[model samples]
Structures are given as C-alpha cells and as structure tokens.
Target: MCACKAASVTIVDGLKAAETKEKCPLCREARVYEGALHMEELNILLSRRCPEYWGERLQHERIERIRQAKEHWDSVCRAFMGV
Candidate 1:
C-alpha cells in the first residue's frame, strides 16, 4: 500500500462517508472530500492488498455497504482469480 498523501486525504466525513466523492456526492454537484487525518487511513491502505474502505469517516450504513462490497469482491476474486 502506498503511504497516505496527507494533502489528498479525505476526512470531512459526510452522511455516507464515501472514500471518493464519486461514491457519495454531496450538495448535488459540489463534492467535498473528508479531511486529511480521516482520509489518511484510506489513502495509505488503498494500495495494500485490501481493495479499499471508507476508513473512520464512514457511517454505520456506509460501513455495511463497504463491508458487503469487500466481502463480495473477496469471494469473487478469491474464487476466480485465486488471489
């Protein structure tokens, strides 16, 4: 995983707490990311074997979604790609 780039970290923490603005767009078109500290974890861990996560900035609902996605992805990739 690539160490987080503090300047690009997203830690603002929206209602859904999306890692990227595309995951959860706020205010219609004005997509604001989280603060650096909060996003540091994501930015750092993203390059790791782990697919990706919302980090601490995510809400319970979003956490579940991320978990489900990861679990599904892991199952599919492991079953097919053998990773």
Candidate 2:
C-alpha cells in the first residue's frame, strides 16, 4: 500500500497523471457533487481515514499525554516540597 499523504500527480506529455493513487470513490463523488460544506466534511473524513493522518494524530496525542503527565508530576512534587 502506498503511504503518500496526497495523490501523487505527474506531468507526462503535457498531461496530468496520478501515480500509485488510491482514494474513496464516495469521497471523490461527494466532493464533485456536494457543496462546499459537504466537500469540507468529506475531505476531513477522508484525511482521518488515511493511515498517515491517523498515525500523526496518535503521535500528537501520545506527546500531549506525556506532557500532561509530566506537568501533573511536577505539581505533585512542588506540593510535597512545601509540606
């Protein structure tokens, strides 16, 4: 499976060509047939469905969780020092 974030387009003989591209047909159809709001929603949904997007989101969440834990620990240590 290709792990590209966006559809890879290439110029060949003055024409655009997609290279190793995969997308949800429903999403593409929605973007073409639906309004701006619907297109935006479909785009968000598609991005979330992508593995790279999910991986990045999970990594960010993990980093945030670690940061929050460290903050909580520091606060606890400060409280203990004052006691």
Candidate 3:
C-alpha cells in the first residue's frame, strides 16, 4: 500500500467516491462501483448500526479536528477489522 494520504481528495470527492468502490489501501485499487462508505456517512451509518459509546466529554478546539482524528481512527479500525 502507498503511504499516501487522501486529504487532497477533498470531502466532496470522498462523498462522490462513496457511490463507487472505495480507494483501498491494501490493493490500492481505484476501482469504481456503488456503495462505498465515506468517512462522514460511514460514521453516521456506524453510529446507527453500532453501539453508542459517548462516555466521556470531548474538548476539541473544533469539530473538524475531532473529525480528522476519527477519520484516522476509522482507517486503522478498517485495517484491523478487515472491513
């Protein structure tokens, strides 16, 4: 896998990519298809499907910072969970 960040891909671009096969880190596949899960949507979907764990209060400077942190976390989880 390429040690590349998809930051420049833009949030909207990622949203658009959601309708297709997601950019994979393992295969590095840029294949396009339907139903790929972007971070925001994935968070929403996961929030609905998974258990809620809002145990502690977050004191981030901005929501963007928190979101960015979760995005990194999500990638790591995906890798480990083999999602």
Candidate 4:
C-alpha cells in the first residue's frame, strides 16, 4: 500500500523499529531469499514470479516514456523560442 512499493529498501530505522519479516509489496508473500543483483545490500527482492512486479515495471516504463516525450517537447519549444 506504500507509494514506494516498487523501490528497494536499504534498511532505514525510523521512529519505529524496522520490520523483521520481509514480504512482497503486492502479493504479500514472504521473500525468503536475497536478489542476485543485491550484493547483500538491499533488503527487498522483486521476483519475476510476482505478477505485480511486472505490472509495476510496465507502469514505470510508461511513465518514463511520458517523461521523455515531455523533455522532447520542452527542447523543441526552447529551440523555437531561440532561448
């Protein structure tokens, strides 16, 4: 339910103690192992088996495309204005 559901957690101890158990953001399943690319740093793992991960990836891709489009338009406008 968190806004950073897709982001990896790097172990930050807030006012409350850190969570002892780790689970998938969408499926709520236990993450029993570390990600191969984590290198013992990140605590959360996003597995391909989770459908939500793929969904989030697609959403992220869409957002990135939108950002690129906005940047392209901004550049074109700037060039037109000769600024």
lDDT for model 2, please: 0.46
Off by over 4 Å in 2: 1-48
Candidate 2 lDDT trough over 10 residues, lowest sum: 9-18
Which candidate gets the maximum lDDT versus the true structure?
A: 4
| CA lDDT of each prediction against the hidden true structure | 0.44, 0.46, 0.46, 0.48
lDDT of 4 by residue, 12-64 (tens): 21212324355556776664223423422332344446668857865775686
Candidate 2 residue-wise lDDT, 1-83, digit = tens: 12112233221111123332344344643222222235346547867689797678657656755766687789899999994
TM-score of each: 0.28, 0.41, 0.30, 0.39
Write one digit per residue (lDDT tens) for candidate 1, span 19-81: 444322223333433442454565467546444453442454465557666877789989898
Alpha-carbon runs more than 4 Å astray in model 4: 1-50
Indicate whether candidate 1 or candidate 2 has the larger TM-score: 2
Backbone clash pairs in model 2 (N, Cα, C under 3 Å; residues 3+ apart or in different chains), count:
0
**Is candidate 1 or 3 superior in TM-score?**
3
How high a TM-score does candidate 1 get?
0.28
- What is every candidate's alpha-carbon RMSD to the true fold? 12.6, 16.6, 13.1, 11.3
- Provide the clash count, candidate 4: 0
